[model samples]
Target: MKKIFILSALAFSLAAVAQNQKQAMTKPKTTPNKAVVYQVFTRLFGNQNTTNKPWGTIEENGVGKFNDFTDLALKEIKDLGVTHIWYTGVPHHALVRDYTKFGISNDDPEVVKGRAGSPYAVKDYYNVNPDLAVDPAKRLEEFEALIARTHKAGLKVLIDIVPNHIARKYEGKTNPAGVRDFGADDDTSVEYKRDNNFYYIPGIPFQVPTSDTYKPLNGEKNPLIDGQFSENPAKWTGNGSRLARPDINDWYETVKINYGVRPDGSKDFPQLPEGFAAKEVKAHFEFWKDKDVPNSWVKFRDIALYWIEKGVDGFRYDMAEMVPYEFWSYMNSAIKAKNPNAFLMAEVYNPKEYRNYIHLGKMDYLYDKVETYDKLKEVIQGKTMPDPISDIQNGLADIEHHMLHFLDNHDEQRLASPEFAGTPEKGKPLMVVSATISTSPTMIYFGQEVGEPGKEDAGFGTHSRTSIFDYIGVPHHQRWMNGGKFDGGQLSQSEKDLRDFYKRLLNFTVSSPAVPSKFVDLQKVNREHMSYDAGLYSFARWSDKQKMIVVANFSWLKDSFFELRIPAELIAQWKLRDGNYVLHENLYGRRHALLKVVGGQGTATISIKPSESFVFTLAD
Candidate 1:
């Protein structure tokens, strides 16, 4: 009787395993929708005041509030085809604004960047910036409402997580139960400890940075602007400056966080396993689930989890490369364990560490600034040909999906600035290439669509890049704001045209099947033709359902008429026989071309105007 029961149980277990295998094999594979991230400086998005005052106070140049992002405003942004809204500078940072009555401590002007303060120098991780709220005490509640409103508008929320550093006067006023501020229990007598929150220079007093031409508030008088800060033992500056008195160029407003890495640059924490890079995020999480970690690591991990719990869809990690990858494996894995679909992007510039960060660190994306953005800038400025772009894309082919492409961001100069392309029209072709060339996410700054040149010298930040450190209004974006109407009622004809083009292009990019499909470079083959010049670039993207041929003219002063050829290999890949095919311009549907296919190869006469591009699709 026992043997018969054992046989029956074995048979039942085998049948269950077979059923599970069949279900797994028959599960439909779904492709992920590409993300279109709209990064807006939260403090500057809705300010309609056009007082272009240098070194202006908040009253002189109005400040945008959380309430400014009304339902109408969010709907307009969503209609622009944005999937995620990265609300930059949401965290409480060191600023000159006084909210002493609300029980918030004052930040010394000597350690603050501007009247509005640098968003990167975070003062409190547990709370939102008081300046963004209608009531100083209700800041967190207002921010939570914004998150809810963003979700109701069919968009995700993204905020900054500055893991590498924090403001020199780090304080968390709204800590959770039993939570403590960073460096609260550190032994300051030693320079390095495995669990110490910061690296210290024992017995050295902190000295404020000195600059001949620059001042904290442009020589404005304030009680805390005396160029004296109180720190008995100076900590290392955010930019890794070891001196007690950091240089003018150093990030003196913030102090670095130590994550188990000693002064000799060796990690005291546990390293990831040899094969962990290829492992899943859950596996990485399991690896660190029971292991002991440094106090700084746990603090950062808790901070990220806290934000995730607060309905933030993701984070944009600042200077992620400065922090160790193992900490990311721990922190990000913890985050993924909570929300598997969280969007994790980092600002890592080194090309060599791209794969490590993406795979081992479990980052969803990294900025493609150094290679793609810089090369595109060179091409737009007439400094280099677009030929190297194909190489750059191919070099990072294994990790292309992890690279986020953008023509403009807060750190880079605006596309319309004189230092950049000098006009918003020049960004048309570059935008096409940056958006459609890869399977990665695409980002655009707040004022990019309507062409804010960021030419104001607002306080500490100069022209070309929008000021994140001062109270100022974006003029061109304000035109679209139209005094809180959230409509483009006051936009000029040219500005309207530009915004229209962006809407069409971005909407098509997000919904097109061919965008995330396989790409074939046409620039290499087209280089042999006489009409195909360095100023022109072409490519093909095709899948089982859709096929597209993209061509762009980067020249600002020339038009191009070329015999765009499709090699026999690509024709065969598209399953085309010897016949004629009609290619319709999908951008505007205004132009169509006839492609003659003979002996499996295809050729068409294509004409493109300067700073114009087209995504030609095969007609049904």
Candidate 2:
């Protein structure tokens, strides 16, 4: 009997110790910092104007008045608790082309016919258009001030940089090399086109692919000049004039840089589109002109570095895949080496290749295309909820290493379109999908949470019905993307509710990602409707020693009672006889007589309702 008594006493001691440990776990939390981010295209945010309208309709218009960039910043953004702001195409000079050769209407997509070209078709990277940058002289100060104000508001800034190519037509120089013509007439002769070996490709995209099209002007023998229309085959009396637009070469393509080959087989760097074509430039050796420099590319690295030093944290490298992966790695390291917290995001429109950017820490974030696309489809298409667990999980794995998580930004389809909204009733559920589930970092495009105002789709010649700019009387919206003015339609009360819903979720995500997992374990509460994405999810979090119970439910449907194993020791101490319950930290640690019943392992059952979720922190 004495020996039995001793054993019983020892058992009680261990239970008491376990209870103490459970209580001790609640030390306190400094709160986890959230990486939730927001992005936008500033020109599209404000008043519409006609003077800047390159298109006939508001949906196609994108140019905003230069001075409006600073005016659009409202108080709502800071209160939203986002850490980052991404602006699209700030410095793109308008190069609306006159494309009459295509035999399409000036208003047609084929004929640019003087419309605002995509900022990606930049004429110069250095200068901001006076129209966009109202006072060119004070532009830099204004930009700096904007950055300062953003930082003061507790947000970082991200600007887009298109490194692939520049606009040829908008530039003052008729030559593809962008050299000043200097009072030169439209002379298309051997002497006029090629001087000191300098020549540029013609307006035509693809006709002749060789330097053999080049011949020295006045028969001079310098390696510096090449000209467009080289295909004209100077004095090819051997045959008739082919009339093919000659493709002359230029120093920009041949000049080498700090990096290795220019990808175009010339010393010149940062030229031409990347990928398959760059490799093909190798087959025709005679087509390439050599200046006898071993191998060097343009000093684009220095330019990016200079930008980093000038108060920017990092860059969202446009077309990262077009550039060599090694260089991307080096650039990421370079920028971060300067500012440890710097983020270098990549722009990739593809969905399946999303994982590639995370390979070398080369990019802090590339939009999570799959998650956004799939979830949007599921919600908007009346299809069952998508089982995007794998996709979302893959995204989070990268975020563990500081990867950027997101929904929509400047490029591609807007998230607010029909692609994400099914019926007005499902809008809130869609918002939940966007803000929660996979637990990765999140981003929303500008005006996304607010609703997309109508604008004309210049590329497709259709109009987006969102016309908040028109409704709000934005002067800049009238100047640009809206072709001076527009109204996609009225904002529905449901849509407004959806926006508020997103704000709530955004605020929650920022706080929840920081939760300390004690006994919490997420489990599939039900697979019945889970495949259809119409089920509740239950997570079991327990403080074994605390002997408290926490039960939570997740779903966008009407239901009650989650099926879970209830631990007896935890149950004995507390009665979990109900549909839904939450376990606070204090309850998980406090001593109570009922806690005695919950020392043994078992399962607990809980319940949930539509669009509702729960969390339980069990204690002794």
Candidate 3:
């Protein structure tokens, strides 16, 4: 009897060991902390001036300086759960402000967008914007100091890289020892050259675009605003307008950079290999390690490396799809070689090219505008139900992690704008969905938390979208700034509560285990069996040690009460047996629901207020 007992004990121990090994093999890999990006229009974040005058100069409507980003401001931003801060409009661009005394030439008002210029129309890749510096002569030093301060605050930095175009009067006064300005050595006699920096119309001179209602400086009298700027051997417009006299709608303020793609749409550089899309970033780097590329490609590559050396953490490429994919493969590979974990994001709108940009172009993230943002906007406006979101997620399952989600940015209308959802409260549930839906990074514009409506009709930009072209104070954001205290001192009670919700949601999102874990669509099953409303969306996320059920109500007028169900397949995957489990709300921690699992399936009675969301975790 003793021998039989010993054999049985030995068999039980061996079985337990085998099962442990199997479970370990099947467990999901731990993912890194999710990145939460806060994109601040650098010039607008710290400005306290409330005088939003139309066609205002920097003195009339104050501009935020690099020195204005005090340590307190950065700490406040970091405490809001932001891992990265994208300081937009940091590079030297053509502005009406005079810096000619500092050896920088005056930009003709006819060629500049506003009193403060469009940040995308870069005038110098080697210098910082003089308008953003307290001392224009020490602009670069001031920017470097800001970068150091930002890092000391434990936050990463991101800046823009507009590769496809540049300000028409391109000038780089502070190029490195061996670097030269773009088009310095180009042969302007031909329209297309394998090594030329720009495409030219040899016999023609560029003409300023004519408009009936628009004028430089809004017709304010200035010597340089004579509607005639000189450009011999006319170059193609930034938007690919081939005419010497482009239409008023054309991107007339900028010139297109040549990447060896001729006007006939033929590539002059080496094409990527057939299976290169599936290869790793290192392999792409190796492919371009010694190969010769176009002059424009080398210039942009050098520019990126230069910024990286300045302690800039990453770049947000503007109009990345307009540039060739092959160049991105080369450029991004070089960036990664310098900093292995550099955050590379881009603005690629075409859904068809999303995979190509992410895989072949080696981009870390692409804007999820056309698919996710557009659909969510419709749901927010009551134009459609939330049922299509699951289909969109399913379609991009393979590359979902590469998609970056945002509701507002420099380009999009503000959430509180009259044209959009029209209220800050409507964004609560939408933000919850945008942040918790996947492992992708979540981004919030500077004033999004306190609900800044882009309603100021600042010159050159009307309502619905905040002005990127003029000097204007963000009223709602300035209230939170509270005269540079960064303490939200002047915010109303409702605004303060909204910001608190954002802080809680963002902090929880970055650290939650279920955010980057396995996600299962619970919408279909609930709709079929539990009579779930179309105005609500549901999903489940879990790991070996954590289980979460996320339900969001998109309805603005009606609260929802329903029996949220979990299918047998998910319960089996979760390794749960017949039992009663308590699920505690993770966001507010004020609510708890009892989940009963019988016959391998589970059901929970859930009641969510209108425009509210709940993230319920299995209680220990």
Candidate 4:
């Protein structure tokens, strides 16, 4: 009788515990991910010229360093029609770890080619890159100011949040956090420990601007940090490559955001599965929960909150796919909960596979390359799309769900790169038409518009061209959608007009609704070409209240054409004047005209010019 009572009581206790855990695991609230994200590699995107000089350049000259967010620049981004701006690599790159070879330093650069590294190599967490921000307090304040301005202009802000890695370089002899040297023994509570078996000459960039950058303690920089800058370069370390993976995860947690996974595969914190008294599991969670805070995911949330507090709308996660989807879902949701209208996006090169993550509702967008390749191939092959525009339409739809759609990002070869296109100038048109009508949230990278020649070499082989601060081969004129080099009197008019033409198309996407809205549909025409009944490349979109048809000629030498026949049901619904189909068809000399015939088909006709994309739509 006693044994039976004990067993029954234990069962009841177990049930109670299970119910408590179930309640703790409430589904996280989320918002719809619908943002047109603009991804900017701050270093590459900005004006930093360090050509031929041995040292990094911080030009006090013209159009060089943007201390303040110019209305001209803001207007340019806004005019492009993007819903949000994702500024990447915003931390200070004042520390020139390289070019110490001959003697030149950051202060005396004869000319540093570009800006800083792609912003992924973070030297400090607190400040914006000086190359990008003229004044730390001022610039940050201005950045927030710009956020307010951008929103006023109908745009949002999304800065890059790198919770994964840090710059292999450092500024000042003092390591990050102002400690002499951090070791496991110095602070057992320290989540990461250096192996006694190894020695480390910590990476510390000498000139990280205090006014513009945060300073971490020693042993805190990434393994990739430039050891060459030190007296005994090789002696320093391989960005802590010797560090353990679990320790790496913990270090990343300290270094960035919510990265390290619980040893027992549970969430970090008071939130954990019941009965997790396992010593190792309990030990890992307890250590991180109490000791690790610098690189807390809450820290990432804090940074975002800081931006939002400062007035920038939000942030875009760099290489978001690498991080757990739950992290994004958490941060993104937290952000919206704080600001109902903030915009967020992720740079997952592909969106389909990441649906599980994206659909959970924190990532607002992703980078879409499917449309990129397909459109490029289409133009180059001179092939017409078949009915349903399956690839194009579906690609856009997927992006719409995740805020994808772009011409080029900082990580890959520029569409204008010869490897992708035959030459720089050849791929300009391909970039323009493809990105303009793409249903994904569209954005053009910094150098993409002008086809910056460094796309392939900028960050190739061993750690992407030394410094993003080194501005090499950036053009005088914007080369994004169209045009090329501009001389005083030579090719100036043509180049200017061509540039303006791209601007108009970009603006059209932003200002007009027909191109990106979900109402458009694709229809099968003939095997010769795929046709849309409405929107860009569409034959027509019709209903009782409105009618629209758009056609573009994507070929240079041939007269491209398509037809849309308005159905009799639609005509009856619209109550339009019934037209004799045969007469209109015969008179038009083309089967492509809306004609009310016996077949109840009012055929619509379309003709497109080489590389031309147009929209035709009418709605009440």
Which residue pairs overlap in candidate 1's backbone?
A: none
Off by more than 4 A, model 2: 1-32, 48-74, 97-114, 169-298, 349-356, 379-385, 390-403, 423-427, 437-440, 453-496, 513-525, 528-620
| Model 1 worst lDDT run, 10 consecutive residues | 1-10
Report residue 201 deviation for candidate 4 (angstroms). Answer: 16
In what order do the candidates fall by TM-score, top score first? 1, 3, 4, 2
lDDT per model, in order? 0.88, 0.41, 0.87, 0.43
Best by lDDT: 1
Looking at model 1, residue 530 earns an lDDT score of 88
List ranges where model 4 is wrong by over 4 Å. 1-56, 59-63, 80-83, 93-115, 135-155, 168-258, 262-295, 350-352, 370-389, 395-399, 421-439, 446-469, 476-491, 519-523, 528-557, 561-598
Q: Is candidate 1 or candidate 2 better by lDDT?
A: 1
TM-scores across all candidates? 0.94, 0.59, 0.94, 0.62
Question: Across residues 1-620, which tens digit of lDDT does each residue of candidate 1 receive?
Answer: 00111122223244444343342212123343678999999999878888969888888998899999999999999999799999999999999988889989999989988889999999999998998998989999999999999999999999999999999999888899989899999999999998899999999999998988887798988988777899879999999999999998899999999999989998899989899999999999999999999999999899999999999999999999999999999999999999999999999999999999999999999999999999999999999999899899999989998999998888889999989988999988999899889989999998899998999989887799999999999989999999999788899988888888788777777877777878788998899988897799989887775678899999989978888999999999888878666665666655556566898889977877889887877722
lDDT (Cα, tens digit) per residue for candidate 2, span 349-418: 5644554455532466775555554555453454653444434544555353333455445544444555
lDDT comparing candidate 2 with the true structure: 0.41
Displacement of residue 209 (Cα, Å) in model 2 is 18
Question: What TM-score does candidate 4 reach?
Answer: 0.62
Query: What's the lDDT for candidate 3?
Result: 0.87
